[model samples]
Target chain A: MIDWLISGDRPRSVALGAVLLGILFSLAFAPFLFPGVRALDTAATILIFIVLVASYDLLLGYSGIVSFAHTMFFGLGAYGVALASIHMGPGWDALIVGALAGALSATVLAYAIGLFSLRVRAIFFAMITLAVASAVAVLVSQLFQLTGGEDGLTYRIPRALTPANRVGELFGVRINGRILAYYLLFFSCTALFLLLLRIVNSPFGRVLQSIRENDFRSEAIGYRVVAYRTAATCLSAAMAALAGSLYAIWLRYVGPDTTLSFEIMIDVLLMVVIGGMGTMYGAVIGATIFVLAQNYLQNLMGAASDATSALPLIPDLINPDRWLLWLGVLFVLSVYFFPTGIVGRLRAGR
Target chain B: MTQTLLETTDLTVRFGGHVAVDHVTCAFRAGELTAIVGPNGAGKTTYFNLISGQIGASAGSVRLLGQDITRMGVARRCAMGLGRAFQLTNLFPALSVLENVRLVIQARRGKGFNLFSIAASHVEMTTAALAVLERVKLGALRDQKVSELSHGNQRKLEVAMLIALDPQVYMFDEPTAGMSVDEAPVVLDLIAELKHDSDRTILLVEHKMDVIAKLADRIIVLHNGALVADGPPAEVIASDVVQKVYMGREIADV
Candidate 1:
């Protein structure tokens, strides 16, 4: 059914095909592509990062709000979900509740900032968000009792949201493992992606683009300029929270590092900008690139370790802690050659 | 004889000690077509801005239908039965011509927050928008994207958008500035029709003497941010000050 829907090239068919393909591809490849804690951890990092970037792009790319505090919303989601889960214990319902909590908390925070700063466009809005994120990070770190401080919190969870009672029985076949978890996350990501796609194509989406093109004209037409900005801000934040909540659930752990880390924020930004800021599929492309690059690059370094330890080119010369430096260089290069990112370049070609 | 629908009192706008608009006072009455004529830098556009609330009045007040609206924002002022067609074409270019007009109708109805519904599917709004487009003879171009429309059509679209809101008072700043000779009469016809509507008031800033002489029932002449003459167009245009303002100090030689 999904394949038939995807194979058709009409507008509706194209949309459905893209969505089904996304879901199928993610579910089919997640296990083999990302195995064990190390691989799963890296893949998870890329997934959450992509979600964050997509959330940012929804506002910055479409609505023209350059927000730097996107990580703050991600943190809010992570912290909100983790805290909610800690008090309630892990369950299918608990995960849903946690996601909702994360979204609500991020929305509230975004609302406060948006109410005051939506009037300030471009660099000013970006600065305000950065300040807010830094402040939240500081507050989280100082509150060791509730947050478990820098070390973070750990949890044990049932194998599944419903806790598969018959571990190896799914359609009379085996379906018990981390593969199930991967498929669960893959579905979640795809659902959010489709919802975003619907929003950007709608009338409301056109208005947002109009706002981006020229705000004064939008106001002249009686659209409340600030109101649109606020709504977009909250919606973007909520999407980031959804991603964060998934991360907490998948890992069964949450902490300040997950929420407040500068590294996490940059990673998300990289995915969106490198993949294509405004294009809907840019986040997925970005995540795939980021994950593949990190995996292969690390493996290449490991392979060369025996031969190059005496005259190490990267790890010895530059602190491994600064692996982000290389990512920064890549970002700069992408900005120079493909300012619109991959999706943007493809759009320009078309 | 018609009641004043919009008025500005001693409207002074200053930019860093230089007065852009200096103590200009005017009133626009329902059923009246008024032309404000001045050469470039005569504060005509500044006065329009002050009335439209695009920029805050440095020291003055604006009254709309006898209510003080000095502090109101542009959107609120628009919602309060005031509409403006800009000197420059200000429009949503990516939207279809019909959608552009529908925006103003939607604004007047104040249903902008129906997030779940498709905007293009709003039947009543689309009908109203198309009606205005038809009035401007832009109905044929309704489905075309605004960016695809020609400059004159875009200007007509701007006017149609303003008309769709059904404002009690319409402010048009140089409405025919970029129009061809053929296009100018269509705008003149629309303005004349608007003036004849009995309940509609029109205020315009124009340099075109032909339009001013043809359409203006009352003409207010300004020179260097001050009123030089205010009366019927024949009387005001006949004034030596008005003749000199138009002829640039060489009317006697001409």
Candidate 2:
């Protein structure tokens, strides 16, 4: 059963397996365990980032194709949800339609971009995606009425998905639309993660990995390197779009800053690298570590500053505002210590 | 001629006015092992590249079983039964030796695009891949990653992949280029076994005169991107022009 669940691709390390289970159980019962609004949001955000980063890994890790337009697909999904809510009214039907629309656009755009650039080479794919993503970001911010401009859009979903609509009281926690929404994200993300796991273990996934190892060899062996790379790009883009849809649905808001930011792309890259680039479980671990750090690192710094008030220059150096600097330090330390990322480190039994 | 399996017409390629391969035409046939021999800069490898679709021709066409395939890319040509093994041992280095061969079989079976098929559950495919691995005596190292394998082992894995491909035309660019003195015979024996099939067309590029004399039935010598000699191995080796251009001047230059 475990083999079927993970598609026979074990974590290959007892510690990694235990940590993954810890994460899974924690995420599965997040509301009951955490029971706070901010914590719930952070957990959901982590789940969303897991899907996004794993999708990107399909292109970069599996196929050796580096694309920078991941957020563009993510944004399209968000906007699809936003536009559907605003135009077609707040219904589950609208959500489905919006998600389908978003995924379709992302897939088509990815196919177009991949066909144009992937056939040429890797660097060209990266450059073209960066340019296209930037262009899309500018277009989203410029088209005020259509995409809500720079201010973004705020819309509503069904009452069962909001904070106030309490279904009942279970234990100390409120049984409300918010918890339902969280569960929705949880199940979807888990299914998506497992699906990705299955894909990487499939024959198609082998081809992609082979391409990463040696494209000329793959071609000589009868696999079309460009076609496989392009297919990977399209699939990754669509998955990112689905993730964006869930993100919009969770927040009930969509905007360039939230979904289309290039920073998010960089974060995804960092997460993929930090967790382990070539595995789906890497996304799970990397996104959890990163999202947790992003949220509570500031609090840790503020508390450190308070405790170190008597120290000279130390408090200022470790100030809450220097979280980004500390994050950089953390990234460097990880790359130094793990080299292949934490998952890789654990898998190697080191 | 047994059966013309592959033909090239005026096949040529230029690297910026430097004609790496001049207008050379030849036909490869079933039940024949043709050895392409050359001195340095004779374009033997370039001609292989042209026929295999690794590079576009400046002025030529490649016909496989009477189908024009000059414009087809590497993968397409491979799918059409044009199998090529490189001198450099191009292989998926991070994957297991079993997987490296299994992928070629999957590709030949048109199952490379399958998204949900568990590779291990494909019992027939696994057995077939294992059989191919055993052919090159890599069955024991099936689970070992190609990157970790020795250079000679990787070369053997390359031939395993080629055997799995089961192409009509088998092209080897110095199959024994980097093997040890002992390891060279394994690949040579495999090529000899394939040559016994009688319906398969084999093309080889080799610098080792001993290897050429042993495996190749026909020898085609290229000098400065042009065909200099074509006949039996003994005839070509003893030919006056080949003795002078290939053995004497080129040897002196080296």
TM-score of each: 0.84, 0.97
Against the true structure, candidate 2 reaches a TM-score of 0.97
Q: Write the per-residue lDDT of candidate 2 for residues A1-350, one digit (tens) a residue.
A: 87987888999899999999999999999999998999999999999999999999998888888899999999999899989988999989889989999999999999999899888978988999999999999999999989989999999997889988889988888899999999999999988888888888999999999999988889888888888988999999999999999999999999999999999999999999999989888999999999999999999999999899999999999999999999999999997897788899999983
Instruction: Name the docking class for model 1.
Output: acceptable
DockQ for candidate 2, please give it. Answer: 0.83
- What global local distance difference test value does model 1 have? 0.76
TM-score of chain A of 1: 0.83
Off by over 4 Å in 1: A1-24, A27-50, A92-97, A162-166, A169-174, A177-180, A296-337, B93-99, B123-153, B247-254
Per-candidate DockQ vs. reference: 0.34, 0.83
Q: Candidate 2, residue B217: CA error in Å?
A: 1.3
Give the C-alpha miss distance for residue A160 in model 1, angstroms: 3.2
CA lDDT, candidate 2, residue B221: 85
Please report, in order, the local distance difference test score of every candidate based on alpha carbons. 0.76, 0.91
